[model samples]
Target: MTECLDAIYQRRSVRKFTSDPVDRQIVEKLIQDAQMAPSAGNLQARDFIVVTNTAVKKKLKEAALDQKFLVQAPVIIVFCANTPRSSRIYSGRGELYSIQDASISAMVMTLAAHDMGLATCWVGAFNDADISEILMIPHNIRPVCMLALGYPADTPDTPDRIDASKLIHWQSW
Candidate 1:
């Protein structure tokens, strides 16, 4: 239980990455770990697109509102929600659940990467249509978030968090 909580506290959004290359195998391992996250109705309605090509990264950088640091990372993992995959089962609620599934998986992956001595930054600010066009994603798949993955070049200081009592609601809001 402590090990689980440790990742939550220790993980930081690392933007500075070393020039070292992240092996495909390691990235694959991270995805595998992320897949362990529970999905609604066990639909597992999500997909991870691993991007290593610099040309593509440049396009993604632009799509991400010119976040230059994204190109510095050796790998970028695009977290997508396969809406149709979920919608087939749950109809109207499936789309929402698919997004949740993808988000949960991404959260799990950030911690898994942290545990494996790697750093990641969750990049969510991006043009959805641009990303989909760049990635050549199908109609059913929606790009929800991106993960910048690489070895750390600089360690960031811990960020401040809101007080639990202030943020959390007990029985009602």
Candidate 2:
């Protein structure tokens, strides 16, 4: 399999992370790679907040349904969408498109992290208002998701997935 495909297949949502710190340069490169992901109308409405401070991460852990992994991870990337930016072009659909853009970017970051021998867990179950309050996210920017990134502390068995035959539909549904 191709290197990219190998990385994609091997990628998993790592929940437990070690205390080892991730390199700043590696993190920057990962974000830069994520920027290359396609965006709606090329607006690139996604914004990211990298939190490494222990205090901030602790607050985030609390805000994220008391997920201890958030605090254990060395870095937490908060993905947000700038609705107004996409709204300039798509009107009513702009906000939705911005959300899609952010999600795509976050996925790219996850894959890139995996390829770099790092692990990450995409977290969406959080109180948006609480995260915004802790991170001071602007009102116009919506918090879409967060990613906990760091070295793996344990290897988790792959979860079962639905068979492809059951999931795939022909040309029409």
Q: Write the per-residue lDDT of candidate 2 for residues 52-170, one digit (tens) a residue.
A: 99999999999989999998999999999989999999988999999999999999999999988899999999999999999999998999999999998877888899999998889
Clashing pairs in 1: none
Q: What is the TM-score of each candidate against the true structure?
A: 0.97, 0.96
lDDT of 1 by residue, 1-173 (tens): 59889988889999999999999899999999999999999999999999999999999999999999899999999999999999999999999999999999999999999999999999999999999999999988999999999999888999877888788888988
Residue 82 lDDT, candidate 2, scale 0-100: 89
- Positional deviation of residue 102's Cα in model 2 after best superposition, in angstroms: 0.6
**Against the correct fold, how does model 1 do in TM-score?**
0.97
| Among all candidates shown, the one with the greatest lDDT | 1
Choose the strongest candidate by TM-score. 1
Whole-model Cα lDDT of every candidate shown, in order:
0.95, 0.93
Cα miss at 113, model 2 (Å)?
A: 0.6
Q: Kindly report which residue stretches of model 1 are placed more than 4 angstroms away from their true locations once superposed.
A: none
